[model samples]
Target: MIIRTRAGALATTAVLAVTGGLLTATPAAAASVCSSPKWRVQFYANTTLSGTPKATFCESALNQNYGLGDPPGVTLPKDNFSARWTLTRDFGSGGPFTFTAESQDGVRVYVDGVRKIDAWRNVTATQRRTLNLSLPAGSHTIRVDFAAWTGAANVKFTYAPRTASTVDKVRPLAPTGPSVSYDRTVNRATLLWLRNKEMDIAGYRVYRRPATSTAWSRVSGTGLVTSDTYANLPPATGETYLYEVRAVDKAGNESTGSADRSVVSVDRTRPASPTGLTGADARGGVTLRWTAVPDAARYTVFRQKRPVNGEIQPVVEAATVTSPTWTDTTAPERADYTYSVSAVDAAGNASVRSADLTVTRGDHPPAPPTGVTTADSRYGVHLQWSGSTSDDVAGYRLYRDGELAVDRIDRAVDDTTRPYTFAYEDRNARYGTTYEYVVAAVDRSGNETRAAAVTHTTPGDRVPPAVVTGLTATPREDGVLLEWEPNQEPDLKRYDVYKATWLGDGPIGSEDGAWAIGQIAWLNETDTSYLHKATPEGETVLYAVVATDDWGNSRAPHTGQEFAWVTVTELGTPTEG
Candidate 1:
């Protein structure tokens, strides 16, 4: 008989029993002939079920009908026969279950020998009964009894689990008989396990972990697997990995893991090649660097001397290090070499070599310019220095006040000779300002030497203003009006005016002579015109103007012949001055 529980239907065997007493069995009855667990059935000739069973065998289900006829494998009075079915099996984490039965005449159900369903009355139509009960975890037994008294004969009994998540709180039993197989050609592992007996089982989950690690990782996909087998690709690093399976139920509850199955994988993959290789000539050695490779246990650096005149050199191992940088202190000076790097894993698999990098050793900066000197003049500051003695010197660089004033100055042809001299004029320098100058020598390789520096202050302005031009004297009644073009000197202090008397035949007063008026008026730099008032009437007056600077350096005054002379008439009208 297939008895339905909340989890699923379970096939059971029958044990003959009297209506009011337990039936005895021989020792051979303990051994069942069924391939799989099934319902063991027996038929009795009497309705009270009081004698040896006429037939004994196993059937997958209890549903049967015999209308006015006898059941198969038995000869009985079609209307007064009895049958029974029973089974004992594990109910892993059992929970609430419902038992249902329908039969003609009478039928009853029991759990662990306790009567749970009773409908023991003969009926013309099929009688039905259902009972709900809680089944604890572990082994349990179920029994069903049916009797046919008259007319049609039939019986059906089944039970199932209450699969509702809120109703069934028990978890499914753990999957068992787990086994794993590995394929070295593909680096993959396949796991298999016996399915759990729980009919409400949703699926199974497969888990894996390194044999040395305590943590486990789900190898199956995110969704629960609905099959008893799984396939996954484990890392092929020559390490042992453990695999297990777990059962999940429709209620979303999961059981404990099954026994662990382990497999050792073969390693054939190599680490990735290192990249971004570069090299530089350092003070202590030839330093090389490259990008780090994942899963690399160490890096190997290889180098070979550059071909000279088409002659190739054999490559040699430089160094093996765990970091991304290495220094070869034994590298010879003044040589060119090509370098490459490779990564190696713990399994001794080496990756392909990285792209090669070319480097030159013994590259040093040229010597700095020496004998630096500075001199200030009225125009600007002047800088002079001796060229560097180094033959590889490409040019010199100049800096003013810590800023680059000149990018480069080509080396002169005479720079190779003794007493090398170079000069640069900084016209941008201002008067009375202090400045710091630095000079360095650069080589073709872009290496620069220590700068030679000097600090100096520019001299103050001592230059005088230029002579004034466009001097004119207009004869006005009040005085001789004078105006002249303004001087453009930034340091001009003022203008000085002088007056002299002119006779009818010759000039009487001169700028440097005793007959001249020494000075008449002093005007500020912005005042270019001056009015000399109250001059002698009907007389010729001589005028002169000169420019002076802030340092008291004045322009030479006009001589007698150059003075502006103007004659006045009795009406006070000036002729010319």
Candidate 2:
């Protein structure tokens, strides 16, 4: 529970005129007027608060101390006097609250005219009284009364709402008198409303919606507005929009929305520019097409002629159309021109022009190439196609995997049987890889027609790598160290070392079967040397090396002078023992 002191002095004073060392003949009339949301108070000459008040002024709170002296701006005696403070304020969706009062003499508290706390007894020290109560929603009046019979005199009273969400489930009242004003120069709408009366109000939420829409959007963002005013920038489309505000309490409960306010926004927004504009020469004329723009009612096309030399002609309006496509039958034949487009809305606002497109009038693209075929070979991928039937066809272009691979090819077979036949081999293509090829035909005017496309996967490599050469073996105290030249094949996988024991021989024969051959070591493609540590001393050993490819193809192992043979020596001997 939180307790707040509603403490302040009198807000207004009633002047009692005194003339010529004597008081005025007319007594000052009692006037009770306090600023909004402040307490109204009255002071009496008697402790019973009977008869007319000696002074009636406004106070912000009931806290006061007049120790052996009269109250300020009042004629009440120092002792045997009384004062009362009262106010009627909205509690909104009220919940639990704590009321407290402290006094040196006597004090009492009342809510809506019903007594809630009473400490009506004279005391030498200040006496305190507190009580908890559940308040209902809406406006209620609170009153505090204090009397001093003798000695020091002081009194204080305060009340606060319990804002715990679990204990306070009441929602605040809706904001009142919501109004809006629009500034056409800045395209902004300012909204103002009366603040909620709830003491526990957290903040306000402002919402907006188009006049034609039933859905509302929260324009205040994720956070609540702590002020009574808000500014929003609605679309300046000359449309009418509505706005409303709601009050939120500390418990997170929101009230009903306030009355809707309307504003007419200025029309300053323009339609979006056209996009994806394309122009092509056709039999009738030059045709232009573009993507439609949202909220656009029509479109305008602009054109300019391209000269062979010097600066291009000035751009001029070509046509106005409602649809996204238009044809210019006025364009002359065999001429080059550039075109652009812009979109217009119903409000007569025109957007920026679209990107320019160049087209040659009466110059049509050649027909696409046909009879496209692909074949896999050991060399690479093979592509074959027939030329376009169009007489204006100048050359051909090839695209591999959507990228231009061959820029131009002018040569074609001159044979009468297949006069337009063409073939191309892609030597850079790798084996066991897939490729997509496209064949296009170009016209004299540089217009290319996308043509036949073919997909092919090359066969896997089956050839073995070259035999290992320059192999050398040196007998050491630990073992025989063997080395060889590395193979250059791209698909080489690894190398294998073979060793055989020569029982009795000057030179080992290729077909010798008495000596068993065993692979002593398998090294990766990058390794070019190996050390055989398991060789027996005093025995002649033949070492052979072979290269293998990724496809499991290996060179045949050979035993000759190329394959070194050395006799193992003792630990300290340089020659065979």
Candidate 3:
């Protein structure tokens, strides 16, 4: 049960009592009156304290005790006695107040003759009863009845408010007419809100929260800003911001927030152009690489194509990526191709195209490497392929389930003309999982032969993987680098890394907090770390990991006891690969 009372210091409990018999006669009026606001007291016979009082007088306060003794004036029974006290006064405006009444035998209180509290009962100890009342403006009568059938006789009455003040009773209404206008030329946003109509309002305060963030912050530094208009706010570029205003009264009561307004500040400045564009003509595709561009959200590749016999056009868009490397697998065989890259900011502003790089495919492409095979064991998938027999052959590239699993073969060969054996272990492949594999043979002149595909299904392994630990994330200019202690489970296939844009109090897939966007990257069982090079700058990124067994069973990162989590702010300098 909730009890609401006026604001004031808490008061101590009151105790009172009366009994079966009272003094038989009245006492002479004391020479001195019972102070200013005294209480009219009366004593009566019978345990119910019914009929009229056998003795009458006035007391300055309720603090009273009548031990084993006769009445000072008239004679009356001592053991069983009853008494009643009445006080009347005019209290101001209606408000929450507390009324406390105590007694040794029994006691009850009445406001304006209406029962407000009742604790009447026979007892060896003093009993106390407190009642909170909302008194109206006017004169009211307060009466307390007490009885003492045995033992000690005592009675006390007191009351006080509960809260420090009644200001909380009033709340300012929400602000209206909220609006935001952004000036692109001046690069500032002006906010306007209707002034609160509350008479006691001290001032207004503005709050701002970034569109991508869940936290809110006060925008004003000075206390109680009285202005209804906030001008010249330079919000962050390339982001949308939310704003609201709240009114605070002089009594320190704050009203609900006003309707929110949102504004988008587009970043019009272009990013630095990517440099060092170079292309290598290889079998089946062209491989391109470039130096990283600072503050570039992503790199857009443009291919220079000749639609007519003589006219050259560089309008053909290729691909976009945070990584600096890209492979064009659709380049026509034995054809010349020119490519260039341009940096794009988050606001879609593009920089000038980098220098052009041209590469001509060789006339004779390398022969397709034959005899591709895979061995699926409980550990992982083991792949083997035959080297190309052409003299211009460079090395092989491997693909898993049609995805570029390995960009290039790691083994070094002294001669390209002779057929040789190439091997790779796909330790990250889970057991009980079927996978398709393909290998391509490329030559020095950027010529290539189509590779034959191979399929293999791993044997099932039921052992669960161990939880990953030592997770650490390092911020970089281009992205976030994550590393963790490798799992020791022999059947561990690979590690799946998950990222969350926000961590506290959010909605996830079927969960209420820590929503995982998706798997950011996968790592081999032996690999301890991975790098993400395209995260947004000035934002914190949260990461978690899960280790999967050969049979596809997984162990998620421990969220308790020892939670494996890493946070990094996007502030790293570009470390181009």
Most lDDT-accurate candidate: 2
Ranking by lDDT: 2, 1, 3
Predicted candidate 1 versus true structure: per-residue lDDT over 1-577, tens digit per residue = 3222222211233333343342322213543443344677777877877787765666677788766666653446647889888777777778788899999879989899999989998898988898888898877888888888888888988878888888888888889899999999998899989888776788998999999999999888789999889999999888899998989888888898999999998876689999999887864467898899888999999999998889999999988999999987666657898899999988788999999998887866765778888997556988888876555567888889888899898745455665377888899987668999998888777778745679989865655577677888777667668888898988888988877654344444544434345687889999889887775376655676777777676654543223333333322545797
Q: Sorted on TM-score, highest at the top, how do the candidates line up?
A: 2, 1, 3
lDDT scores of the candidates, listed in order: 0.77, 0.79, 0.71
All candidates' TM-scores? 0.52, 0.55, 0.27
- 297-332 in candidate 3: lDDT tens per residue? 889998865445677655688898888999876555
How far does residue 174 in candidate 1 sit from its true spot (Å)?
Answer: 1.7
- By TM-score, is 2 or 3 better? 2
Deviation of model 1 at 93, angstroms: 2.6
Off by over 4 Å in 1: 1-36, 211-215, 268-298, 304-335, 351-358, 363-577
Q: Which candidate would rank higher by TM-score, 1 or 3? A: 1
Q: Candidate 3, after superposition: displacement of residue 491 in Å?
A: 75
How many clashes (backbone atoms < 3 Å, residues ≥3 apart in a chain or on different chains) does model 2 have? 0
Residue pairs clashing, model 2: none
